[model samples]
Target: MRKIPNNGNLKMTKVAYPMGLFVCLFIYIAYIKWHWASATQAFFSITEAAAGARRGQQAQGPLGTTAHGHKVFYGIMFDAGSTGTRVHVFQFTWQPGETPTLTHETFKALQPGLSAYADDVEKSTPGIQELLDVAKQDIPFDFWKATPLVLKATAGLRLLPGEKAQNLLQKVKEVFKASPFLVGDDCVSIMNGTDEGISAWITVNFLIGSLKTAGSSSVGMLDLGGGSTQITFLPRVQGTLQTSPPGYLTSLQIFNRTYKLYSYSYLGLGLMSARLAILGGVEGKPAEDGKELVSPCLSPSFKGEWEHAEITYRISGQKAAVNLHQLCASRVSEILQNKVHRTEEVKDVDFYAFSYYYDLAANVGFIDAEKGGSLVVGDFEIAAKYVCRTVENQPQSNPFMCMDLTYISLLLQNFGFPENKVLKLTRKIDSVETSWALGAIFHYIDSLNRQKSWAT
Candidate 1:
């Protein structure tokens, strides 16, 4: 090779090419390192935020214990409604003279008509144990079967196919062997949430008052559930009313009346109500391209005859002038009122309340809007404006007071009871629905400690 001397003004092309490539490679590696560092920092920040939240939860517990206590009780509850399943786990301590201290909590979601137990129990445990596992790294405590686990299912579990429902229960037992178990309808759950530890007293007051006023020894309570509704008709005795207004009956006359109430858990009612307008040619939308099934409750009504109409639902841009069946299914009280010829006799019956998981209010809101702006309930084509009044009662006295969650009123009429008192209490109770499970756990544990103290 011959070496050629060049002027300093221009470098050779071959030498410049390699230098450019080297610079490009160095820049690319540096960019990747910067991105990796940013990503790593972001991940740690998220983790720290989560940990800080958990620490805040732990700080809410009894002093010298939340950060150090070993005897922690974990309560887990699931309320499966017509719309969805909700999972909640709360950590607490049962210490003397102090409130059941809440240390940690978490939640998860499941379909409305499904059972929580059908899902894997350990997987469905909301990862509370995982958090505890990490906590054990710093604090000294044995994780080997030390914490008590409480888990229970309600409402939606009862709607599953029998075999499936039982399987779900078995799984719950397998996962949570310790702690007392309680299962029942959503009514009791609503009662607990709304009544705020006063469910028993309120139930007693309503039942006795209703029985006394009706002058019947028997009474029936029909509670609407999401997947299914319940009709509980029992023999109740007419007792004395706590207070009676002038011309208002003071006590139930000596009438030993047998109650014929039904808590008809119609698996179809909730779904049926929505379908009626679209199905059965009632709302006149020309049923979508599929098999249209009328709920059993609406079977007779649809079978009788199809009196077609094309009524437009103004609000939702849904036009349907269908027959009565489509519009009426949404108003259950009317269906019952018209079907039962002995309406006069049942008129005196006191107290009707609807409690379920699905949003009855939202469903009816759509139905009423489809009916050109009103729904007919109990012989009244109540304009949509007044629809919610029936279930929750009209908020006319104070527009701020009506908290009706549904368009229809399932409770009773004319009981001479103080409406304001009942409503105020009901609203106060409604406010606690979300906090019920945790509140129940807290209340139950507190009661146990109090009873133990009295004995000692």
Candidate 2:
């Protein structure tokens, strides 16, 4: 879960978890406290240092534990997705007037997502609490109250009935309140699709150090998951922004800089959801009392059971004479119709794609799963055609691979990427897994800072 730098000569050992995290956590807190030195110092004189000491408790620590006398801090972010729930516990180190840098991350995941327990809110708590325990283990006991813990449910809960989703979040909040970690009113919630896409973009650009550079152009991000897919990028062309439809573009201000980006999330366009749609089945619904879901995208005689969101579906290939690839492509196109917004600027922008996109490419030998690699947009097209044709004849093989690959190809085309456009597929960039959680933590901290006026 933790990615250590290979170039660092610092001696390392297995015992460096909580202690290491403790130091890092204090550094970040000190960084924040240092920023509020003016307000903290003024209060130290007017109201005594006790008040300021309490405010800077986690942010300021002994100098021997930190390099620049800056405190380290921790953030706990839970990614509650359609397929599973995951915990990302991050430790950051920072000095005064400097940005926090991630030093370590402890991550874990559990199956049968929070959404799976929609019918029973009580059943979801054990899983949520298990993830929280990960934070408790890694973070020092004294720092728990200073650490902010949050859980953001994505498409899984978003697709659930509004009341059910809210109930699940409330249950999680109850659990959070019981934990020692700092929690707030905004600690538990369902993330909006727009925010999901934009946060992922922030993560990608942040990792690439593009956001820190004065004039460096940021790369775009494409995140394909189990229940939804997101595409976000900064538009370089003025016309692309001006001519775009509302909600397709969002303005974000971070660290005194504003960025207008093109971002959108298609909820039902994720790989798993696309499989259900292409197989002529509705999400979260039984198919007519054991009726089968038949599609040309599978082996002609292929009949099998596919499980999604803890429900199994009886699925098989159609017996029609229509070309499977042609028909499947058409079906995917229908799903894409009017659901995706495009900007010509994406044609010239570089992109880093992850999640299901990286998984599928890695499975098909199109790219390295771990090391990641670059490929043309046409690579997916090529893989789709071959897999669809081969799987058509070899029905017993992975029948859904063809459909999933084809849908990805078409999805990219729908996003205005040309066949010749190149994209990078990766799970981790620079030893850290690229995800929206990091961006979410930064955003959460920004909000807290605004509340206390620490970011001014």
Candidate 3:
């Protein structure tokens, strides 16, 4: 027989079972919430720490100080050229009592040079500020105050009227003053042709490791820009110093040493300017009555337009079945005669040609386009003849090739470089640009350091 269960005891057992299950479920949920909250806190902490570290690193400087406690500095150089405006942000490492080493360089270029805004000075601000922004991006914010900012106007502004050039420079100075970089009264000046030559000499010599030691022979510099061409070398012979015409020699003091350099810049003799002169077009002047410029340097069948200094002109080749090279050479001679001062000293110096010299040679396969190569002075003449012949046949190819090649050949001869004289042509050396910008910045920094020492 089944015995009757105790009613009170059964009721108590049912109630306690549900209560115990509820308690266990509540504890499990609490544990999960605690774990999640802790994990989230840890994740946020890690993120904040990483951001703080990055901020600290930036404050220290880009690339920071060297192992020897030497400081790393920066310089911003704006090359206001005839063709374009270029900014070079140079990272340099300096040790006490040693020449600064260019660790790296950042460069960018914009077309329509500073002189393009001669009539409207305010319009040039945007391009100038754009290039400065590039420098801001490449350089760390901490170093901006110490870095020197300079813009050296080349033939572009040199060709401008004195008052107009000053206005352009004053505008640049105003922009520079508003920036974070160091600016001086002389910061934005038209670099004279002589100074331009000397600076280029410094750049080439420093890059080739010639400036590190005393009494080492320095290579000569041949720079052909858009509006002018410069030839500079340290004269070894006493006769060179004595015979050099007035205004052809300049004495430069750099790194506590003086260099009496034979440097000359031929104004209106640059490739582009020469092109205008060759085409019978006057600078800063449009063709008379919009007349077309006809020359034998171009193929007889070619007709086109050429622009220089913001002036455009219609150009065509003369219809003549003549020796193109000879005719072109005759015209180039007429432009260069009595203009270029010939010196025998250029023959003995190991010379390096740059700018249009390199460009023209590379165009005709006379040298490697990228790596650059050596060629004899006569190579230009030979290439000119070949290109002229090819132009006569092709006619539609590079119309200016015949003219440019012929001009370079004759120009080299005018400088006293013989047919067999070898010239090393390159756009860069040791991965650094062969330009006056670097040397200009170097000199400017050196001057600042000297001034600081004197003040102390």
Candidate 4:
């Protein structure tokens, strides 16, 4: 190597040093590329997850777990009715690709209704906030932001003037916005008469497990609220759909099924409203010169004060020799004449009547107050005649018993329910109240999910 080194050895050494350097450079570059790619993938994954959360694509995990490892959720619905405002806090659970299960329901009610504050919209805030507190107490802290909160006004706000109703709703929206729960632009609204009927229909069918299966025998819903009465049934006969009056047939979509139902809400035909009408008093208006309202439905010896729609009136029975049921029936017939559209299809459908129907039936021993029962349309008539005779001979505790029974009996007949037609009366089904609140909330959640899907 010292003198005249071999030419092949020198050449080999020179090439080997550069080749080694090039190999080291390639390895370093490859290491850097691998780390950068991994970091970029991680960043995108986090970004996508955050975006999904923002879109209400909630994480599926054990955070709010139930039996079968189902994820739990909640919905808060405020039913602003003519008589009162009720809050329904519902805890629901569901697994992937399944219908939600109603695990628990917490309900609270406050009196005098939101419409009581129509003149003073600000006064409605306290009651709404109180109900919201009930929801907060029932639902977990983690679900506050995830839960859907809504308030639906029924006939109470529907009867109000447009401007007044809007003001009250706006006040409610303000309170909802300040709360931690999820709120939307359409959170507070007055449900139209048809929608009210459809919602109750949904509630009854859903609670009975009919909505879970296709082609299941579905029952009709009859809800007699204070200010309105609803009759809703799924029509199986083509004659019903073709013969139904305009505004009576409505389409309801739920759980991926479309239903064309025979539904109608008769305003001013509810128990309370009918009482006012039968007594010859105008709604939302005081009697002229503070006069008294006399009706044959009351006892001739009875004289008292009756308050309706925040107005008190002196009411008395007419000094007539006619039968109480006879006179009251005639008067109720007058009120109902041409007011309701009769349907023969109702005769064949199984019906569940609630609200005032349940209250009246329970009051008269027709059904158990807690458990509820069934009654024939004729049962109401018989109860009416019996109660009428009793009221005629004695001072009754409930002065309107005779009148209410007669109205209900005649109301059913008018709706084409024969005397033998059986109706199941209940205030609750499966420990949950049989009201429009549950159904309305379900529909709302469904719509929200649909909207989110569309956006994505």
TM-score of each: 0.38, 0.84, 0.84, 0.86
Could you give candidate 3's per-residue lDDT for residues 209-318 as a string of tens digits? 89887798899999999999999999999999999999988878777778899999998999999999999999999999999999888888888999899899999988
lDDT of 3: 0.87
Residues 350-438 of candidate 4: C-alpha lDDT, one tens digit per residue = 99999888988998898999999999999999999998888866656899899999999999999999999999998888888999889
RMSD of each: 22.4, 17.3, 15.0, 6.8
lDDT of 2 by residue, 287-347 (tens): 8898999887886778889988767999988786357788888888887788877678888
Model 4 regions lying over 4 Å from their true place: 1-69
Clashes of each: 26, 12, 0, 0
Each candidate's lDDT (Cα)? 0.35, 0.81, 0.87, 0.86
Q: Which candidate number would show the highest TM-score if scored against the true structure?
A: 4
Worst 10 residues of 2 by lDDT: 56-65
lDDT (Cα, 0-100) at 248 in candidate 4: 88
User: What is the Cα-based TM-score of model 3?
Assistant: 0.84
Local distance difference test, candidate 4: 0.86
Q: Report the C-alpha lDDT of model 1 over 163-256, residue by residue, as the tens digit.
A: 7666655544543342222222221222211122122222322324443344434433334443333333332323322221222221111112
Better of 1 and 2 by lDDT: 2
* lDDT for 38 (candidate 1): 90
